[model samples]
Target: MPQGPGYATDLADRYDDWFAPPAATTDATVALLARLAGSAPDGPLLELGIGTGRVALPLAARGHDVHGIDASTTMVERLRAKPGGEKLTVSIGDFAEVDHEGEFAVAYVAGGTFFELRTQQAQLRCFAQAARRLLPGGLFVLDAHLPEALAAHAGAGAQTVETANGDPVLRVRRLRPAGQRYTSDYLVFADGLFRHVRVDFRYASPGELDLMAAAAGLRLRERFGGWSGTPFSDTSGYHVSVYELPA
Candidate 1:
C-alpha cells in the first residue's frame, strides 16, 4: 500500500475551507444522480471518499440512507459537524480496506476524489471494492478529467482559492498523463502569507476507468460529460461515468 501522501496533510490542515465538500456542488450532483439511480426520499446510498460530507450530508438531508467512508480523520470529523450530519455513519480508514457490511442502492465518488488515489492499481482496486459494496444492479458513479482533455489543454494552467474568512491561496494543478494514468501536482501558496506545495497523481479517461470497473465485475451503465448531463466531447473537461454491477 502507498504510504500517506503529503498532500493529504495539507488537505487535513485546510479541512474547513478547502477539503470540505462544497454544498452547492454536492447538491447539484446528487440531485441529478438521485434521478439517475431512481432514488426515493429514502435511499440506501453509499459514498466513498466522503470528504467532509459535501455530497453525503446533502444526500442525507434529502432523506437518503447515506453511508460514507474516507481515509482522512480530519475530513470525517469536519463532516460530522455540518447540519443534518449527526446521524451519518462515517468511517475513518482506507476505504479500500474497510469492510462495509451492506449493499447500497447507489454508490458514488465525487469532486475529483478518484484522481487522488495515485496509482492505476489503487484506482482499479477502488472499482473492485465498489462492486462489492453495491447491491446487484446498484450504480457506481465516477467523475474525473478525461484523457482527451489533457492533450487539448496540456497542463491546464493556474487556479487560485480564497477562503471566506482570511488569506487568499494560490493553487495550481498540473495534469500530465503517462500511459493510462495522470501524474499531477498541486502547488499551493497562502498568497504572500505562506507558501507550501504538494505533488500527487490523478488518472486517465472513462475508458480506462471502465476497464477497471470491468475487471471488478461492473458494467458500464451511462456516461455524461459533466454533472449537467452535457454530451461528452473530446474537448470536455471530464468524463462522468455511471457503472452498474450485474443484477
Candidate 2:
C-alpha cells in the first residue's frame, strides 16, 4: 500500500550479500547504540526500517528487547530466517504512519534510511511518530548522509560500474536540488540478464532535521560524524544525531 518498501523487491533477498557493511562498521554501530540505550532493563528498543535486522539483531543479542517496522515482507522474511530473528516483533507498513503499541527507551533509524521518506512532510511525520513512540527521556537516533555531499553533485547525474560477487553492477544517480531529492538505480548482471533496483529519496541537512525534531517536541542531544563519536564538522560526510524527548 505504501508503494511496497522503498527498496526494490529484486534486491531484497540479496541485500546483505550485495550491500552489507564491513563487520567493523556493524560492530561500531551496535556499540554506539548500546551505549546510548544503556541497559536492557530501561525499556524495549524500536528500529525503523530494520532491513534484515542488520543493527537490530546484534542489539537483541546483547539482551536489549528489540522490535522493528519495515515495509518489505521479503526483507523481513530474510530477517526471520536468521538466528534470533523469529523471536522479535515486526510490523509491516510505511514506518512513518504505521502504529506500534507502547513506548520505547530508544528508537533509531540507521543506515541513511531516513531519506526514504521522499518528502519533507513525510519525514516530519516520521519524527512525530518516533516521538510518540518514545517515553519521556527517550532518545531517537538518526544516521544519515550529509546533504552537502549530494548538493555538490546537484544538476547532474553520475554512473559507475563495479563488480560485486563476480557480477558487473552499474549504478546511476541523479540529484535534484529543487526538491532536495535524488534517485538512484542499480543494475546487476546475472545469468546474462539485468537485475534492476531503483530508490528515490528526499534528504535534509542536520539543521533541517533539527528543526523537524523541534516541531515534534524533541530536542537535540548530540551529533557525531560517525558511530565512533567523532566530532561533527563541516566536512563530515555523514552524521549520527541523537534527539531526546523531555523528561
Candidate 3:
C-alpha cells in the first residue's frame, strides 16, 4: 500500500482558499453526485479522499449520511471544523485499504485524487476497496484527468484560477511521461505567498481504470466529459466516470 501525503500540516491550511471551486461549480458537482448516488435510502455515501469536506460537507448538508477515509489528519481536522463536518464518520488511514462497518450507496474519489496512488497495483487495491464498501448495484464514481489531455501539454504549462471576488492565481505544471507522473506548483499573487503543491500520478487511461474496476467486480455505467453530462471525446480534458457493482 502507498504511504501518506502529508497535506494536513502544509497544504491543508491553504487548500480551501487556494483550490476551492466557485459556488456554482461546487453545486453542480454535488448535484450530479447526489443524483448518481440515487436516494439516501439506498445507503450512505463513502468518499475515498474527502479533503476538507469540499464535496462531502454539501452532500451531508443535503441530508445524506457521509463517511470518509483520508490519510491526512490535518485535512480531516479542517473538515471537522466546518459546519456538519463534525457529524461525518471519518477514518484516518490509507483509503486503498480502508474498510467500513456497512456498505454504501456510492463510493467516490473526486478531483483526480485517485491518481495519487502512484502505482497500478495500489490503484487496483483502491478499486477493490471501493467495491467492498459499496452495496450491490451501488455506484463508484471517479473524476480523473484524461491521459490524452495531459499528453497534449506533457512538458509544462500554466493555468489561471480565480474566484469572482479574488485575484487570479497562477498554477504551473510539468508532466514527465516516462513515469506517467506530474508535479504542480501554485503561485498565489493575491496573498503575496508562493505555495508549492506536488502531486504524483500513475496516470491511467480510462480503459485501464475500467479494467481495474472490472477486476474488482464493478462495471462502467456511464462516463461524461464533465458533471453536466458533456459527451466524452478525445479533446476533453477530464472525465467523470461512473461504475456500478452487480446486483
The model with the greater TM-score, 1 or 2, is 2
Best candidate (score: TM-score): 3
Tens-digit lDDT track of model 1 for 182-210: 44433444445454656465666677787
Clashing pairs in 3: none
Inter-residue clash pairs, candidate 2: none
Better of 2 and 3 by TM-score: 3
Scored against the true structure, residue 128 in model 3 reaches a CA lDDT of 93
Top candidate by lDDT: 2
Residues 86-182, candidate 2: write the lDDT tens digits.
9999998888874788789999998778999988998999999899988889999999887776655443455444333556666676777788888
Which residue pairs show collisions in model 1?
Answer: 43-65
List where candidate 1 sits over 4 angstroms from the true fold: 1-13, 19-24, 39-43, 151-156, 161-167, 179-192, 197-199
- What TM-score would candidate 3 get against the native? 0.91
TM-score of each: 0.84, 0.91, 0.91
Model 2: worst 10 consecutive residues (lDDT sum): 155-164
C-alpha RMSD in Å of predicted model 3 compared with the true structure = 2.1
Candidates ranked by lDDT: 2, 3, 1
